[model samples]
Target: MINIPFNKPYLTGKELFYIEDAVKKGKISGNGYYTQLCQKYFESKYGFNKCLLTTSCTDALEMAAILIDIKEGDEVIMPSYTFVSTANAFVLRGAKIVFADSRLDHPGIDEDQLESLITSKTKAIVPVHYAGVACDMDKIMNLANQYGLYVIEDAAQAIDSFYTGKDGIKKALGSIGHLAAFSFHETKNIISGEGGMLAINDRKFAERAEIIWEKGTNRSAFFRGEVDKYGWVDIGSSFLPSEIIAAFLWAQLENLEDIQQVRIAHWENYHQKLQEWTSDNLIQLPVIPSYATNNGHMFYLICKNLKQRTTIIDNLKSEGILSVFHYISLHRSQFYKGKNFNTVLKQTDIFSDCLLRLPMYYELKVEDVIYKITEK
Candidate 1:
């Protein structure tokens, strides 16, 4: 039996070359040449006002929490069917997380149900673009505008993806919100081992975001001759990554188009091959909303129930094929249990109990994954 791992990080052959070049430049600290290179690449491609590369998506979120000044007693609305980092980021700043449910046809936050959750204490809306699919950003942004709330997009699995708005104008996922975060973790579409980025669309936060990324100092501007002297200016941490990580990320970005094309082809192949099998088995495949474009970050399925999902996983593992389940709703987490924000989430719970992820990676053998899952 051929063992197939769920994810195997891909390299473009230039990772080490760039790392060597970075070392030769003699600066391994953050905000160095390779760091700027990656940042500029994203800014140029996505048209973001500014971009800051962080050590992880969690760091980016924490920076956003600080940038937005999420104080004690403030409320933040986000889907419960997401990674804990999404909630933990705000929670660290003493913000009360107001969890929302997932959509019936999709695992994304149900945009239609958002308005009911807003209150005078609501400060921001953090929408996780689950599986690289865009949440209903138009509704999200409209709500933010109406309620005067900030929008922080968790684009951890959403690189090179797009969202077409009502105006028919397509925008990059990370560029839609007031602030957006992207991950380049080894498990994602891109890999920098452990890395992420924070894109600033709202200009007000651009200058301040850099401060937060540079360990709460004005060091970024001070080095650029913008400030006479830099010191502890505000609250922040060591969010920015070193030149080595940036070098590895730069290599990945250089081949982004090629990588995206290959992953998308694999994604489409899986979708087509398993369509009949999934329907017959009472399983639902991933759904890409009309407004979203497939970046091929992930391909998952909705099993009938928790038992069925577990059975499928065991069957796959027996055949040397690894398959796994996703998040178990934030509200149901061990840490957050009985924290008083229950507010039953039907759709979120359903997804939490049934979502299964098959092998999805740059070098994945889609046929192998399909054969095992569809085998009688």
Candidate 2:
């Protein structure tokens, strides 16, 4: 039996060296030498105005919620097909979730229906770039401007991806919105075991974002000798990760180009091999919009229906290959039902029951598993 796991974290072979370097530097706490290096790398490479290293994408999103001053009774609009952390971050701040529907063709939020869900109580529009594909940013941003709402991009799966707007300019996925979050989970394109970052594009949030990231204090400024002393100045939490996590992430960052190239090659191979099934109308492949570039974060198939998807999973398991379904529609979850969500989420439900993720990683050997899926 040849058992293949769904995801195996890729290492660049310098993780321990950098971690040891951090330990030798005598600063393993957050915002140390390695942390600064990781943060600066993203800012310099991607053109983000500011970057803050956090423990995880969830923590980064929570920091966004706090920086935006989400309050009780405020409404946050986002797709119902996203991860819980996207909504939970705001829910913790007492915001009412206004669940949106996924697009008919892709799993990203439907940009056309975004404005209809807005109201005076709407505080922000959180767009989760599902599978690292960019949502219709122009339309989303226009709506945000018209309604005077904040756009917090949940770019959890969008590292190294891009969005080209109507102006013929290419913007990094996490650099377009007012604030954005990125994940460095073991399953993501880059791995830091458990890490993430917050990108602040809007200048207004720059100073305050650092303050909130440092446990609501001026410790960052104090360390730079800009402030006399550090003290609690606002409502915030400890969101920064230690230098060890940052050091591991820096190692991965150094090899980002190589990692992206190999993963994208794997993505193309799957697409080419699966075209027959898709052409026969037996399954559907991922839809990449013209404005977005694939970061090869994940590759998934949409089965004809729930029953068909189940049989595919069973068949894959019989071959000793692991396949799995993606997110359950948050609107239809046990938790969301308790909140009295009644709007129909047709597309979201379809994706919930039918989307099946194949094994995809930096080192995936596509030829080894191509036979099983091809036969079915």
- Total clashes in model 2, counting residue pairs 3 or more apart in sequence or in different chains: 0
Tens digits of per-residue lDDT, candidate 2, 53-99, equal 99999999999999899999999999999989999999999999999
* Candidate 1 lDDT over residue span 226-256, tens digit each: 9899999988899999999999999999999
Global Cα RMSD, each model: 1.0, 0.9
- List TM-score per model, in order: 0.98, 0.98
What's the CA error at residue 203 for candidate 2, in Å?
A: 1.1
Give the C-alpha miss distance for residue 46 in model 1, angstroms. 0.8
Question: Which residue pairs show backbone clashes in model 2?
Answer: none
Model 1 global lDDT (CA atoms, 0 to 1): 0.93
